[model samples]
Target: MMLEYLPLAVVAIVGVPLALAALTRRGDRALTRLALALFDGWVADRGRRQRERRELLYEVHLEDTYRMYASKTLLYAGLVALAGSVVGVYLAAGVLALFKISPETVRATLPQQLWFLADLLVFPDLSLGELFTLLAFSSATLGVAGGAITYWIRWENLSYRANARARQIDESIARTVAFFYALSRSGMAFPEIMRSLARNRSVYGETAEEVAVAVKSMDYAGLDMLSAIERLADRTPSQKFREFTDNLASVLQSGQSIPAYLDDQYERYREDAEAEQEAFLELLATLAEAYVSVFVVAPLLFITILVIMGLMAIGRTLPLLRVIAYFAVPLANVGFIIYLDSITESLRATREAREIDAAPGLLAGVRRTDDPDADRTGTERPAVEGSAVRSDGGERPAADSSAGLAFERLAAFERVRWLRDLLSNPARTLRENPVYVLYATVPLGVLSVVLRAWPHLVAGTLTVETLDDFVVQAALVVVGSFAVVQELHRRRIDAIEAAVPDFLDRLASVNEAGMSIVESLERVADTELGALDAEVERLRTDMAWGVEARTALYRLEDRIDAPVITRVTTLLGNAMHASSDLARVLRIAADEAQDTRRLKRKRRQEMVTYVVIIYLAFVVFLVIIGSLNSILIPSLPTGAAAPDTGGAISGGPLAGISEVDVEAYTLLFFHTALVQALFSGLVAGQMGETSVKNGAKHAAVMLAIAYAVFLLLP
Candidate 1:
């Protein structure tokens, strides 16, 4: 009977997802609509506490209402449970057909002790009641499992997003404070400064993201600035952000001097950011020691003891060592990498992108009042207004110039121009994102692996131990190339950022010397500002092409994508709108950049020692593994050469002596070193440079040593 419904099941399987996918083309809101239609009665209405809790949860990061987004999440969970139930039924049928247990057939060969077990599981025939019971049990079990999985995912995803934002906010808040403080100094109102920050989320990261919600509430919900600030405090996940906003709300509510408060906050947060970075560096040092002791020393001891136990025939432990070397160690290394990344999150820079104006571009239709060019072109008085008045009391827009169409064309090209430039020059593209190097390296690495591996496969000699050398070599090839290129990219950015403070100081000096911004740029462009000189020239070129100074600075930010650079550009760009004393703003930006660089340089110097310790620890780990494989194992007594004495020593221990598999132990040790090399390098990179990508060279060197040591081993 169920077989008759199988085709319908198949159709439902295909159609439901296809229908959902069709809804996606309408935008994300389409799902919200569909989910509400299906589940609004249950999900939309909630108790007061749930409404409040989920309101806080859904507002900031998700940018959606609890009613809509919650409904969508619940609906997805139910669909997954439904699908799981269908799968359970099908699996129940499969089990019944495949197992088809019978008591008599097993009873003759089975013991009386196991009779109850056979009787319990045996199904003489697939009766209706029996089928229904089995299907119901399986369906209930799996349906609950699926529902739990989806529910966990929903909460986990929300929490992860919240935590990520918290991290981003903590990392970028110092710079964000400086940004608004600069605005305040420029005589911009606090409300306008908040609006500016909201509009520039790309530059400020999660700080701006939080403020953007408040700006929206102000726009759409008719909330005052103080109300929005309070709401922001309530909604933010970061404790730091909450405290900052709470204080800001207090300042706004009280009738205090906002600029003075902001200036003090900016200086305080800058020092706090530095202090926090120092703490992070200390944490990295601690993690480095922990990694070495756990991954290096601990494994060395365990492998040594396991080899000794196998030699004495106390336990057959070759496979255990193999599992430790090949499976457990590498997995733990990856975990360490994730741990490094999470801990370093508070220290990393945010480089998120935000869009600015692309409308009514440089090609605006402005008919000059006394233009000789328009007169020569026979169009002396083309209406520059969006519309023109006609005698019939109807509006007649200019037929001669379509500024909107021109702006649209320019915007269309601007979107793809970066892609075109990337295609035109592959090197710059790779430099922009080192991961792109994998596009070329992966294929080459794979081909080399296949060439080496194909021979082993044909000879029926393929095994992990045999292929370890080849696989690690391929990893080295792939990872080494990426690391080299990644380092180059990092260094390029570093060199450019290093010059930023000097460049800003020089620009300030020139501005204070009475040159206009353009004149200052021309003046500074004549004297080299190191790697930044070229970028300043680019900015100058963009301005020469009639771009606004603010937009040109924004372009410079977009291109540089550095930490201090983003803050500086955002500060300069927004300050120009609110103040005439740009020289003061420039000096402030330069000081901020200089302080950030100073902190980073100190952190780098401190971590260099930890990085060296990691390398030395890794070497010590290898030497221990090497000594065990060579001297200790080779020196141990084999069962074949055990003393034939009837003494207590021989009777208790030597009597159980057995020959160890030296070949397997050596292979495991070799592979263990490789795994250590791979992850230790990543840890070292994270410690020294605050990036795992910087670890590639370290990993390559470790891998080379392991390969050479193993090749020379018996």
Candidate 2:
């Protein structure tokens, strides 16, 4: 009966909306007018009231908000309800079909007293199909009701996003204030400082986004700075932002010293930042202690208990331990790492933004074919000899070819040029983009494994041991090559950073002695500054060729791409534009850079102990697994008959363990050690250096040790 009516049910569900839509377009949209009338009478009141009470529609930047927006909102709500009802009917039917529910089964599943209540509520004397039909209808009604509630909740999300933005503004207030203070000290006008901060939206985050709005208003909307600022204060979600802007506007009106006001604000924010850092460190300490207790102590204790249970021939003991070691510990560690990263993320000093070319691909060695001269003409100018001839039947070698090379030469050059460039600077290229290492190592690793496994494949006797050996070798090759390249890049960056402070100090001294910034840079160009010497020469050459000192400094920042260098260069470069006397600022920037380096070193030193702790924990874990596999499991006696069925040692501690496989358990133990080594290395890197990339070195060490132990000791 249900199958016979299924086609009719589907048509009624689908055809009604499409028919209504068709009618709505007919008779000059009569159905649309009816919909609008229904919305005005029934739905408009609640939405209008909510919009006024919440101010959410305005916050979300919706225009002509109340009546028109309310009608649209209600229309969307109706559509959502329709979609949800249709989905709910199909979902309920599918569930009923899959589970085959009946009244008797429903009664058995329910309590005795609840069965009578269900029977009273139309379950009595109903067939299973009829009951399922009623259930589908009820589900559809609930889905429609849920859609209405969900529509209201979605509107509430606008307010939630507003509050989140408010919190982000609060978080970034210190750095924004610092940028203002630094620029003010260099004597840049207030408007220019605002524009500069606004331009660095990516570096300054939400604070820059808010400032960009005010800048837009000032520039495009014909508002003065004061008026635009006042508007910003009115519209911003953050109370702190409102207070700052309002106080700033008041100071501008009262004729107070603007620099003095900014300096005071910067000092206050700096103090708050220090307090927040202290609080964050306290929280980090608590989390570290918790990690030691939960992941370290709990997993070790559970594994030991599971091993004892396994000795007693307890079923499921090995599976439980495997789950805890392989899944639970790693997942918990990942969660802890994410938590630590969130709490430890503090505001950073704003840095200079690099200017990328309008079309970066044009600079990426891709040959351009869209030049008007080349496009209007059919072919490009040929550089290769014998590739072009004059149409007048005379050779014009001096004039050169107006058309490009023959297809053969172009294709030959294209093929070999890539290989030549790779061979020329392979180290630098691979260091810059380490993913290229996989292009070589992945195929090589797979080839190595395939070569070893080919004989086994031919014989149809590929054993687990042979496959494991191949996999281990492949893993070592891939990870080892990538780790070497990554470590080289990291060390190169570190050397550049170490040389930056001294280079800045020397430049400051020379410039203070009455030389121009260009002259000062030329003086320091040949100095022995480790990794920065060549970059300094490049800066000198850039200036000698008439690039502005500021632009040259920017180019240097781009070339190095270090955060500390970016901050220092941005500070000094901007100050140089405002005043020629940048020696004082340069010295300050140098000191700040050195201080930052010192802090990073201190943090690394403190976290090293924790890194060692993780390594030792992994070693202990491996030892326990090894002991269980080698010393304990093999010692258990295997009976010819079932040990629990009146065989040798029946009812002993080893009873029911007659089928345990020592070899399988040993393999599982070896793989568990390998996994723990990888996890512990990653954890160590994150804890010590605050970078999972830095953990590659630790992972390399741990993996090498594991592979050596399992391969050689056996």
Candidate 3:
């Protein structure tokens, strides 16, 4: 009965739209205006509600909500909706036509085909008009659903953007508070400082935006700097920001020394930041280990078990196992990869948050004060006062401070320090520089290659066919030698850099004591008490062998490339040609070197999180690959194979290749090994704080592990 009336229904639906268009020809403008106003009010109300909730829940400031969609966005959205509706209608009509036309033929030739077509279209066996009616209903339903989903997502995105803006405002307030505190300490008037902040808002990032607002408030509303700051803080969503502003307000009201308070706060911020970084690093290390176990060890173990089981059950193997191993394995591995990436990104975000939270301290450290030298008075004063006496006397030498002490306290456990340094050396460099050890290992590589290929050679089958095996085996040995040599060189460089700083400081001190720079270098070289002493002695030898002092120092700089060494050398070389204040120059150089060292330490701390993440990612990659090979791939039917080549090679040396497509399998194994090596090396290089060459060792290790496992697998 419904089918008989479908044509009439379709006509009525088409007629109604035309009828409505005829009646509302001239009122579209008024209707559109009214609709837009309502929409605007609705959005504003929603925003207000959201702001209220955010304020209540997180102590956020409620900024005025503005309409997110501009006319352009609305126009684009309308265009997209219209296009989607047209596409949807066309598709529905096509599907309905297919269903209606194919029913008789499909039912006659293949009943299942009819059912499949019916399932897809949701209806079948209808006239053209009836099909049109069904198409109209289905297309409208789908188009509306899609449009609504898209709108909802866009709306949610707008809200998220608003929240982010609010957070940015809060961050700005916090930074401004810090800046004002710094300026106030430096004796800048409150109002003048606010103006300065306004002028340089761009430099402050998001914090500058709040400072701009404060400046505007003062200029336009007749509010003082303090009152404007209080208002800004009140409107900010950050609790830390609010607290900082409140403290600033109190300090301003009391007229206390802003500098002293800022200094104290800066130190506190540094300590807190350091603590957060330390925690993040600790978590990162744990994560790295977890990833290694899950990705590397677990996969290897599972693959090993699967291979063993498959080998043992060769005669009884089911076809389904191959399907599972190939298809299932790859898919599962892909899924695990996605999961690992998501986890890594999440952890990275958390780490970044921790870093950002520590920004106050970073800003404090950068803030310059007029009396910058005052903070260093305690340490610098003694050096300054004693300089003249030491310079004139040239007898009572500067005492070796505790800072000069090198390698005190040997381990009770019999020197594990060397072992630590060895492990800490970049692994990739060690692999790439295998030539350093090639002289020692060339014979061994030849032997391993010969021994491994002995069977084929002994059978008078030693031809080009077997050469690849020998070459591969020998290459591995060569690679191993390169790794060992690189390790040796890295250890030497680390020892030199570690000792260069204090050595330079001592040299500077000796130079300050009226000793010629050359004599100072000789004196430190003669001490023969530390790693730097040895390096200096090497320099002295070069000098004794007719090398100029400047040239020898330059050579040392080239070898070590330590920034401290470079700066000190540059200073000494310049002072040698100038009749300037050598003592002051040396002092300044030492201080700069110390600062560089401090910065380096901070950078290392920051990188620790990234290092851990890279390692974790590698581990996850390994686990996923392992799961694929061990479980998924083996389960697939396509992967299943017979043990023999149907007696084609029942009694030849080529039997192994015949029984399996050994060439293909070997190629696949090699490819996998190479990729694993490349990425593993990259991760190891990043983690080990060494060059990419250092990463080669990690790549080699992973490659070796992978190849061994694959070879051992049945």
Candidate 4:
């Protein structure tokens, strides 16, 4: 009877929350307070600290983000469970009806035994209605339990994300501290350095966001810089960041030299970072060994064993082999790859932007008086001012309209700039937006496939084999296009990266010789810096034509699109504002860039062997699969020869292959080889290069090799 009301019970469970919300609309704050009080009471002190760390790591407010998500998660999880319970009860009823499970028959079989148990529990004899009620209650209980478990899992996931964020922040702290040190050496105040760090969050990642939090407290919450640092120190998830902040606060309080403190911190962190890198490299080596043992050797062993079993016509050998080939090997490889990615994911080169900590009137105190044509100081003029007022007070375009005219030209240039870019630097354009390759590749590929499959389509009888051929051709076109484009793009970026350290060093030397940055840029722009010469020339041109030094530098950064350049630009731009003695800052940036380049070189050189191993492993896998399809399968006796007398062959006993489909096994081998080649190439690329995008070229190469081997060798 209770099961019949399952739908109504579920509706009531859902409606209660909506009704409560509607009724408490005017008392929302009270309800929120009540919820917080409940959660606060339930949370122990240790859990509270963890929650605080989670909140600070994610930069979420307690009142808004934390309480709201927690409340919503609980409410929604409960609702889901309630719905599950209703469904469970309804399912129970339907199942009982379908199976004709009569409670009377159950009782009749063991009435005395059941009644004795019921009497001991102080209940009357069990009936069908009571049984239904018990089942419904159990279903509801399970639903509620499931909901609670789900909420716990989600909460744990948030903690994991916070930990990841903390790791990234910790990784980048040394570089970030160096940036602060350099700016401090240039005579910028600590607060100003913090603000600069905040502004360049895109370049520095999570560490910058942490700095921005303090900047916000100082600027908006009326806290002194030292007090803000203290608050940040208390709340940050990273022990390293917390230590840095605590030391910074101590320096501020004790009146130690800020630059000296910063420099010491930078050097200390740099050493620690190097130590961490060595540890990381050691871990990667271990992972490589494990990947070989688990993904390569184990899979090979399994395949060999399964094949041998198949040759003897052992129990369901083909099905087991298929499971190993199609599921086990791939899944294990995927798991290994994910584990590699997780461990290698760095805090130092973290890619995402955090929430911006905006403080009102942040730049109100800064005064800019350098421009002669400006009617007012410290006010930004638009890139394009309404040309000029003629003597008759009418608007007309100015011939020498400074950068406003350049802005106008850009407005016009926007229409067909992509076409020009595509024609001129197609590789770079494709690299910046890889999806563009798909636009051309997808259409051409589809057309090629259509052309190839036209006859089959026209006859309206395309076999699976024909479809597979079309897919293979189309996939080759797509992957091949991406591979070609990405490889070229990678080469271009490598050339640019090679030139950056030298570029910065020379610019620093020139600036140190008493020339302004603009003058140094002009002097060095004409120097042959290989890949960087044209970019330097463009920087000079932008400044000469009345563009702000910062604007011109940023434009150069935009054109180059390398993280190293972005960091250098941000450092130089911010440092140039703090003092004219920017040579030291430039030198520091150059050193950091060199360090980054060295690390990349080291990683590539070390991982190259693993990449080679992957290729070799794939080759081995291909050889074995190829041998099976060509030699063993064909050599097997087939089709009704006295139940194919189990024979001894090649020093091993072989069972008659009575029912095995040679074609099916051959097709499976063909597909497995193709799949292995594709994934192995990807793994090789990822192991060699940090990016999976780099794997596309490897995939293409491997796929081509697979195609050649299967077609010619077979």
Candidate 5:
């Protein structure tokens, strides 16, 4: 009887050996080898034949298929077969049980009994043996088909994952090859570079794995460098990486200077990356416009229409329309939200691309360069042109003799009395050049006054609100002018701060070259370095013009107000008065300035996280409020509340409150919008180091969001 359902019989017989084979193979090399051999000879052969005949289009690679089946296919197939057999046996027993047949009778007729039960389960009214026989045959066929389909789906998924991993590996290899090329230019010997890279493999991702393979090939198998690299490239599936390796091999064979070649390549890459970033930024600007249109303008237009319709039917249709408006507005907002999310993700990708483009330059700057001989000497000789100079007679002096003449000229130029006179009196300088200050502050003051007065003028209350308007307008003008003045002052301070470090470094260099502090300053002041030169000239002029050094530095500090300048002036002032270590003090000031700049950069970076968090929090708030108003609130019974007229309660649970004033809520919404704008401005200022005025753009966006949400609400 079991022979009648031979597919089922086969399953039952093979199931145990498959399960035993799986258990035996674990920690048993003999069993594993046997399984692998069988899979290769049988299963893989079948797959190949099937592929050849085009019976299967997505053919699994023979090696991969062999590995999969040998490791777990047997156990899985056995489980499938065992499950089918158990089901079949249960059906047959149930059939026999239903028939009121004795166990002795069924013992002699297991297949007939199972067939009867299968028939009963499949078709309850059917005759016992006929239905069972048909069902048993169908069950056996179905069980095999189901198992095959499951395995096929699983295998396809595995293949997909493997392909993805291979692509990732390829990209990793390309990046690693580029890195090694860069390192080679840094004067690292080929083998030493490889060794160092291999030691820090984890940082390079999957390329590290390839490096391990190459190291093994060379160290253990005695393969040469070319063979090892070629083998590694072959093992990797990345076209870019293969091209890089081949190029390297060509270079190695041609005996070209690797550093020069790498430098050229790096420059080319940098240009390409910058061009890509420019294109991306252009794309981002377009995307930003699209986002603004979809999320801001479109939503606002819809809300405006809804508001107009509500106002038109203020006495009659508004109650029902308001309820409908709540639901409709929020549902419409979903489209805007989806658009925003898409735009945000696109922006994130663009940002990542920018970072990636910047990475090579950053790495190049930090990477050790090829200058071992220079490093050992502790001093590098200047180029011939840099050492040569023109004498007073306009003839070029020999490089070895021009240093003293340069110093003398520098000292004479530094003694300009007018420069020091100017530094000691910045107010006089500004009063004399009032055009720059007037050009900056006048427009800001006028704009502020106009904006503050426009509201009163629009209401046709110029006469009645004269005092109030005047106060507001005057306040606006004062604040605006103050802000502009502060910005201008800050710019000047920044210019001074930027020049201080370089100036100090140069001064130290000249001092170390055996010049006195005064001579070093005098030398540097006369150089044509613009702001630094001007500042140093001012100091020398102060000394020449009979202004005390202490008074002159204090005047410089008062004009600039940068911390670095303040410290520099204090140190120089103290040294001038107290005979302190002026050189040591100048060095300390330079170090402090550098440290401060570093800290500022670090603080800005840290604040970026907070800025991001604030933006995300706002987005989350919008989404939550949107979801509640659109989906949940509208679903509630009270959501259908009718608009209130003069003291009448109309619809839903909030009928009483409906008659009460909602002017407070309206005011709250407007204030919330303003608050959102304020924080957005703050966030922009903290993260971007932009002026609060520039932050108005971000503030405008946040305000638009808040206003849109308020207008969209029921």
Candidate 6:
């Protein structure tokens, strides 16, 4: 009867979290209401400091009251714990009995300090009453552990978010101050600047979020600007941000010139930003070294020592090595990567490519401004040469005679539009969306694995090694292909941004020299801007037809889609409206773009050392594991550690080993190296480019090396 319900218990244990995760992500308000209705009163009675700590959540814009959040946490965790207890009871009773592991064998294997795990591993023969007691004890223990862990993680995640947001603010506040300095010089009012910054939150990042908070208080809460600024100062985590707000409040109150104050603030923050970034780099360096020592070097040492010691003691230490290889090292590296990302996220340059819509007066502008012939022919006139539109805007005379045939041909051509696009440039789809590589590679990989496994299946010799090879090879193929596409896309975007500074400078110069927007674009397009030349020419073509200059800039930015170029175009588009000195605005935009490229180049140069460190650590790990597998394991006698009564070897490195599964040890070592390769590659990517997507190439390369090395080793 208990066994019958075990599957149900397992489902509840697994399904509850998945269902709750989906619900929480969707922000199901009904669930929130239900949780609050059930546990809100219980949560209200908690400690006072806990209630006070709710401010941290709101500061990071978590948007949940402590009452609702705590109630859900308690309610969800408690229910999950109930299911966990049931699962633990069944596992302790039915599952362990089914395994029927020998208690004597377990007792001899584990060391004295780890003897407790013997009971966990082996199901001892016991009286009915003692078994009941064990089941009951396991229920309570598992229940408590589950609830505590769930509740603690849920509560602590808010603090992590707050700290991460704070880091973002501190790192990017320099650019925010620069925007303020530029806008104030452009004669924008202080409040207008706040509103403008709030509108561009997508481009400006975390500082815009802080500014949005201030703007909300002023607009919706009826607070004065000084009061809002004071509140922001109190709430923000960055010392620089707080100081800037404090000074801003004083300037607003004293009626002092905002531009002059912002100028000083921008200059100070700009200089300080360099020092701050250097400090961040130092932090990354420390983390890289820590990762190598803890995750790479330490695991290697433990595995080596465990293999030797396990041989000496004649114990089954394979379980211990399995934990380090499969769970500890990989999970710790992923967590470290996430933590690094959280801290350094704001430092990474982020971009948004917004589509610029045509103006409401676009048609009116063409008729009134561009087309002097509009009064004569409001119908259609040639705006530019080679437009491909007929001069009279009428169909050809032959169209009337063979209209049906023409329509049939057009319909047939339209049906194959997708084919034309896909085949025109075969890699175009992959270029636009790198992940599409999976669509082609995943099926091919699966088929290849299936074919490789079929012969083994027929022969009934399909061992684990063959299956493992198939999976590893498939992963390399699929991921390697995707990495190639992602890398190509990344390089193309970088090339576009590299040329943006020069393009903007030339556009500004030509426009300031009394050329119209169209003339400036035409002239700029003639100059070589590397990958951006074609895009610039298209912009000229757009403006040459009656699209406004600002609109054309929008399209150019939308196509480029790089964060730096996005920011530059956004600044240019907005500044053009506010100031007549387009030249000055363009100069500032150019300077900002150039600064971003310089910073990125510097970051890559600095990060190369850490990337090298990670690879070196991985190589060291591989060489040691490989040498142990190929050299030491083969040389040792099978019963070397059994006893001095039968064995010639004694009191040396291979002393006192009983019967050991050398093949199992080799296989485990192979797996550990592969796991290390995958994570090491990801960390290297994160260190070098601040992105996991960028690390796939490194990961695939390292995995291939590990796979090839292991094949040669054993």
TM-score of 2: 0.69
Model 3 residue runs over 4 Å out of place are 1-47, 50-65, 68-77, 90-123, 126-134, 158-224, 234-237, 260-264, 267-714
lDDT tens per residue, model 5, 1-714? 866567556666756555565477453444456556555454544566444322212121233334544344543544575566556655665655577555456545543324454433332345878767756765576567656765666456545544543444443442344445445533457765565455434334445555666777888999988788777665544454556667767777789887566555544544443454345345444543553454334544543454333333232333443443344434444443344343222111010000000012111111121333111111122224533455664655344335345434434654663477567885555433433444655676567667766887898766523533344344334433444444455556556667787787777778767776667767888766555566677777755555444555555554443556754554454344333235544554565456445544544464455445545555654564454345543442331454434333342223433232234324422443334344444334423332343243455456556656655666
lDDT of each: 0.76, 0.68, 0.51, 0.72, 0.49, 0.76
Write the residue-wise lDDT of candidate 2 on 456-551 in tens digits.
999999988789889887887887788788778778777888988899899889989999887888998878889987888887776666566766
lDDT of 1 by residue, 154-216 (tens): 766777777777877888888888887788887888888888787667667778889888988
Alpha-carbon RMSD, candidate 4 = 9.2
Measured against the true structure, the TM-scores of the candidates, in listed sequence, are 0.72, 0.69, 0.41, 0.77, 0.34, 0.76
CA shift at 292, candidate 6, in angstroms? 1.1
Q: State model 5's lDDT.
A: 0.49
How many angstroms is residue 58 displaced in model 2 relative to the true structure, after the best TM-score fit?
A: 8.9
**Candidate 3 lDDT, 1-714, residue by residue in tens:** 787555445645544543453378444334344336645554443567556544433232223223423221243345345545655676776665656544456545433323565435446467888877776777676667665666666455655654555555443342344455445543556676666555443334445555667788999999987898888777655555567667877887798877566656644544554464466456546655654565445644554554344433332122333444345444544454444343222111010010000002111111111332111011121121222345566654453343122112221222464356446764533332444366556778888778877887789878643665576557666665566566666566556556655776677678768787667778877664465766687777766665556556655664454445654554444344433225544554455455445544664565566555654555555455555455654543322353545554443322332233333333443444445454545445544442544555655665566556555544
**What TM-score should be assigned to candidate 6?**
0.76
Could you tell me which residue pairs clash in candidate 5? 92-114, 95-117, 115-132
Worst 10 residues of 6 by lDDT: 373-382
- How many residue pairs collide in each prediction? 0, 5, 34, 1, 3, 4
Clashes of 1: 0
For every candidate in turn, the CA RMSD to the true structure comes to: 8.4, 9.8, 18.3, 9.2, 22.8, 8.5
Task: Give me the displacement of residue 645 in model 3, in angstroms.
Answer: 17
Residue range 553-628, candidate 6, lDDT tens digits: 7667656657787777667666655665566566667777787787778888999998998889889999999988
Best by TM-score: 4
